[model samples]
Each structure stands twice: as structure tokens, then as C-alpha cells.
Target: MSIKTTTLCALLGLLAPAAAIAQDSTASTLSRLLECKLTAAEVAAFTDRINAEDVQDFAHAGSDASGDAALSLWKSDAPVTAWGETSDLVHLSSTTEMLLAFKVTPGQELARGKAIVDRIGGMAPRPDQAAMEATYGWKGMDFRKPLSDNRNVRVLVDLSYSPGWVTVGCAYGDIQ
Candidate 1:
């Protein structure tokens, strides 16, 4: 199979729900991107922090217990770690439109971010949901090949609801 096909197949395998033969390819892709393992405590802490802070810029599917629990898991155990000058969690209309921005040292930041992305997975834009109002951008400092000088990486998560919840993340590193 081609690389795209292989990726889609792997994604489908990872996200196929029990007893469901049919799968949403988009959902599968999104889920695979977010497949980073997270600890329950970490998820809980992150969720609690977002909740307490009342971040209303992102869309949250889980407004209930299950959602809360999932959010807790996502926050705590996920591989996407925050680095220098990261934004506080914000709520958007959908996950796809939300962007994660952070500053890091040039040489290591992209690798670090890529590692996180590899662990977590990729996301695509949702067709049914409303897009985000804000556009996310990053600023880079000290440009260099292989590792740019002090720069910011911006990750945009494209979330779509396949009658369920799935989040996909895409990152643009070494923003200059």
C-alpha cells in the first residue's frame, strides 16, 4: 500500500470501535494523531486547570462525566508538553481550529515537538463543525538550518466529530 493508504489503514486500526465494522477515516486519522498515552492524574490536573480558568475559546465535546474523564486523561497523559511562553488552554468552537503555540530553543525544540507529534498523532479540519474565529501564528528568532535560533512552533489541531470525539494535531516548527 502507498504511504497515505498505509497511514489511513493504521489509523483505522487504532480507532475502530469494538463491534463497529464501519469506520470514519477522518475520525481514525484524528484519533491516531492524539494517541499519546497520558496518566489519569495528569489529565485531571489539566482539565481542572482549564475548567477553573474558564477558558472558553475551544470546543469541548465532553461537558459531562465521560467527557470530563476523557479530558482529564488527555490533559494528564498526552505527549504534547508545553514549552517556553506557551498559551494557557483556551476553548474554541471545535478542536480543529484550536492552535497550540510555544517558544523553544532552535536546535532541540522541533525535535521535541516532532517527538510529541509522533507520540500523539495528526488532526484534520472538521466539516460539520464551525471553524475557529482566531488565526494562530508563530514568531521565530535566530534563524539557522537544522535548528533555528530561538523560535516558536505552532501546532494547529483540526478536530472533527465522527459522531464521536477525535482530535488531530499538526505542527509548524521553526516559525520565522
Candidate 2:
């Protein structure tokens, strides 16, 4: 809402439809969907919602994985299980920013991935390149969403897996 921006908008107003101005949405809009200040219970609920237990049994193993970072939600180096099978590394990070490698069943990547995004509020662009990318062998993806309409407060999601390989891994995160 700055003066320069306002003036520019006004000048551009006579040339474009108001719908064009209202359609100015970006990836940053995704940030507002994250549940900030994630807690253990909340994290559990989040995992449960996605139907994955992120290394709850061995969340804190070996040495200090956080390095005195003072985690707020979930733990680091946890063994996350997809669809309750084959324990893997933590997909969801514990911090201001995050990334959730959502677990899914065979051939469930596209549907499952969409479900996660839908839970938050469908991604921007409805069905864009991300969908086309998913159509390929790799059912993986990465995206960013900034909070409060500010690019500074960002959230990101990354689908981790291999090409031409069927695996249970959908990633989500908050961009730092």
C-alpha cells in the first residue's frame, strides 16, 4: 500500500480489469496455512492426520541432533514410518521452518500429495507445473508459501523419492 505502488495501481487501473488486480496471488500466500508454534501433541495430530508416526520410538538417538537449537515441535533424527511400515528418516523438521515427508501407500503419491495441500488450502495455481511434474515417474515436488502475505514468513513442501520408483514419501516445509 505504499504511495508509489498506489500511484502505479491507479495508473494501471484504467488499462486493466479489476479482476486482474484481484488475481495477483503468489506462492507466499501459502505461508498463512501453516500451524505456527507446532507442539508435540499438535505434531502428533499432524502426523496422525497424515497417518505417519515420525520416529516416535527413536526420536532422540545417538547424540544431540538439534545441536542446542531448542526444538519446539517434534524431535530431530526421528525414524518416520510411511503407512506404518519401513521406518525412515524424519520428513517433518522441528523449527520455525519445516518440511514433512509424508508417508503414503503404493501409487498414492498424487492423491496423497494433493490431500496434504488441500488440508492446508489448495495450492496456488490450482493445477500447475507441479501437477505435470507429478505425472512423470517422480511423484515428488517442492514449493514455498510465505506467511502474512510476506515473503519473509515462508513455508515449503518437498516430495522426496526417486524417479520411476514407487516409494512412500511426500515432503512439506516452512521456508526459512
- Please tell me which predicted candidate would have the highest lDDT against the true structure: 2
RMSD of each: 18.6, 20.1
Least well predicted 10-residue stretch by lDDT in candidate 2: 24-33
Q: Given candidate 2, what's the lDDT at residue 146?
A: 37
Q: Go through the candidates in order and give each one's C-alpha lDDT.
A: 0.31, 0.34
What TM-score would candidate 2 get against the native? 0.32
What's the CA error at residue 59 for candidate 1, in Å? 15
Q: How many Å off is the CA of 60 in candidate 2?
A: 5.5
Q: Write the per-residue lDDT of candidate 2 for residues 99-131, one digit (tens) a residue.
A: 323234546655554554455452443235466
In model 2, where do residues sit more than 4 Å from their true spots? 1-34, 38-89, 92-96, 125-139, 149-176
Residues 38-77, candidate 1: write the lDDT tens digits.
2333334433545575423322434442232222111211
Model 1 stretches astray by more than 4 angstroms:
1-96, 121-176
Query: In model 1, how large is the Cα lDDT of residue 143?
Result: 14
